[model samples]
Target: MKVHFIAIGGSAMHNLAIALHNKGFEITGSDDEIFEPSKSRLEKYGILPKEWGWYPEKLDTSFDAIILGMHARIDNPELLKAQELGLKIYSYPEYIYEQTKDKTRIVIGGSHGKTTTTSMVMHALKDNNIEFDYMVGAQIEGFETMVKLSQESKIAIFEGDEYLSSPIDRRPKFHLYHPHIALITGIAWDHINVFPTFENYLNQFEIFTQMIQENGSLIYFDEDEHIAKIIKNKREDIEYIPYHSHPFKIVDNCSILKTNKGEIPLEIFGEHNLQNLMGAFHICRKIGLSDESFYQSIQYFSGAAKRLQKLADKNSCTVFQDFAHSPSKLKATTEAVKKQFTNRKLIACMELHTFSSLKKEFLPHYKNTMGSADEAIVYFNPKTIEHKKLEPITKIQVAEAFGGNNVTVYTDSDQVITDLLEHDFNHTNVLLMSSGNFSGLNLIELAEKIVNKY
Candidate 1:
């Protein structure tokens, strides 16, 4: 198989390219510019393009398929050439579906916890000697790449995303997967840039439930009201399984998950993670894993990258980081840390990074989401707003949207770091949340400074 990628430097695209390349397939890709990690990884595979610009003349009838990335525009020269030549063109999700059509697809979908839940399932499967083709949104601890494809694997696990698939594909990425075993962890309105309204956003998951293969299982979190409503109109052909926070009790900073066999201590804590773990447990059961087997493997699973990942700890304070910028994710992350460390002060910081989070209209959804934090700080770069062609918003707007006296807004990330440096964090837990870089702020370095400063 020969696959040509239009925007090969993307986090997902590059991994898929490499996965296919490692399968002994001919892989070629082009990107106008490539950044670190993706650039280095692609070069390591010897598949990096020699030149920058797209050359339509290089594409011929001999190419097997063209996988398009979201980074590419609709009028991309290579895409146009592929269309002109009548070559098979696929969005990332569409191609993944095409490749895994013969396998039992276990798709994890939700506004939050998708990466962590998918990672949990992947970790368990691998630990149990289960060979599976998988695609997750984040890099995990034991996985070499975010995507894995193999001819021998009988199952394919995908972190189903609700965002648009590609520049020309208006449908949500999850809509294309058509999973045999589908799990909706929970739904909170997200990707406002695409869906635009809560009802419209809610409808996508409804459609997703409808798309589940006949007689397949639908696993979900029972506590979420949105998920409850979706299940009310459940399909008749599929079995429905609902789970809660996995019966975990926090004893002296450690989490103990109560199981039918015995109590299993967890390396990970927090309510959201427990909920994610429960959702993953139900999915594993549907895929032929016993409760005891799942528990044994999951005990060794730490977490996905940037999903409440521990960064530094010293002088009785621990600093953590997360890929949480959406309103639901931000609230859950802040609340989870605060709830776990009840005695300690929780200094929760997040950046308005995505198009949805930066929008003035969407800001109000974050109201009281950070209320659990002892000190809440928000940051947004004005230049980012301008670059995204969004309306200018003030610090007052951000503060007012958060709705608390504890909330402090900063346009500059340096100010946030400086303020945090001078603050006393003894017996305090810090949670840094963002889908971005915090305006070039190196969070890992900041975490080291925070813990070692004293």
Candidate 2:
């Protein structure tokens, strides 16, 4: 297949490009600005555009399909050219659906925990010797590429995102999956710029439910009130399986699972992760995996990358970095880390980097979210808001929103780093949480310093 990607340097876009290139498709992509990892990965594939920026002259009827990325604007020159030529254009999600339409698609969708849940399911399947194509949001441990498509695999698992599919396709990416088996972890209002209100954000999931294939199954978290309502009102044709947090006993800083087959120890912890584990277990059940196999395989499952990933550890000091910017993720991650290190001083640092996190209205949802952390630190770059064309937010607003005397807020990146460096690290566990890089901070170096420094 001949495919062209517009604004393809995005993290997801570049990964998809590399996946397709590996699959023996003729791939070409263009972007005005490409950062590390994406730029290097694309270059490694030899499909990286020689020069950045859209080439209207390159778009023609000869291409089999044009894939659109979220980074591309509606007025992008290549997109306009493709439209002018009356060539078929597919949003990244739409194209993925087109490619995997014939397979038994299993889509994992939620306001949070989608990546971790999907990764867990993938790990279980892999360890059980299941062969399948998949797309997960995070760079997992065993998986080299985030996107994988094959003609031989009869099933495809996707980490379904609720965000907009593309600049042209305003629909949530998960809406296009039409999964034979689907999982919804929870419903939390996010993407304020697109959905505007909580109800509006929720309606997308309602629509997603209707899109499930006839006789398909939906595995959802029973603890989520909003999801419970949606599952209750759904048509009886689709099977609804609700799962709660796994029965587990936490003793001696380890989380042990209480299963029908007896106790099974796990590497990951927290009620939220236990909840996600149950959701993944149900999905595995529908796919023909036995309870015993699931448990045996899951014991080896660490976690998805950056979803409370451990960066450094010593006798009394440990550091965790997570890709958790949303309020739901923030609450879950903080609670998880605090629960794990009940005796240690928890220094939780999070960056308000996403569009939703930076919004004024969305700030209120974070109230008391970081209460579990002993020392909560929030960071945001004012220049980021300006670059994204968002309204500016102050440190006081962030501190007040968190509603904790323990919470400290900083706008200056250097000060945040400096404060962390100066803080006593003997018995403290630092949790750095953000979807962004904290304005290009080297997490590994910082983590090593925090763990070894006195």
Per-residue lDDT of candidate 2, residues 398-422 (tens digit): 8889897899999888898898889
Clashing pairs in 2: none
lDDT per model vs. reference? 0.92, 0.90
lDDT of 1 by residue, 360-452 (tens): 999999999999999999999999999999999999999999998899999988889989899887999899999998999888999999998
Per-prediction TM-score:
0.98, 0.98
Which residue window of length 10 is worst by lDDT in model 2? 228-237
In model 1, state the lDDT of residue 162.
92
lDDT, model 1, position 149: 86
Candidate 2 stretches with Cα past 4 Å from truth are none
lDDT of 1: 0.92
What is the RMSD, in Å, between candidate 2 and the native fold over all Cα?
Answer: 1.2
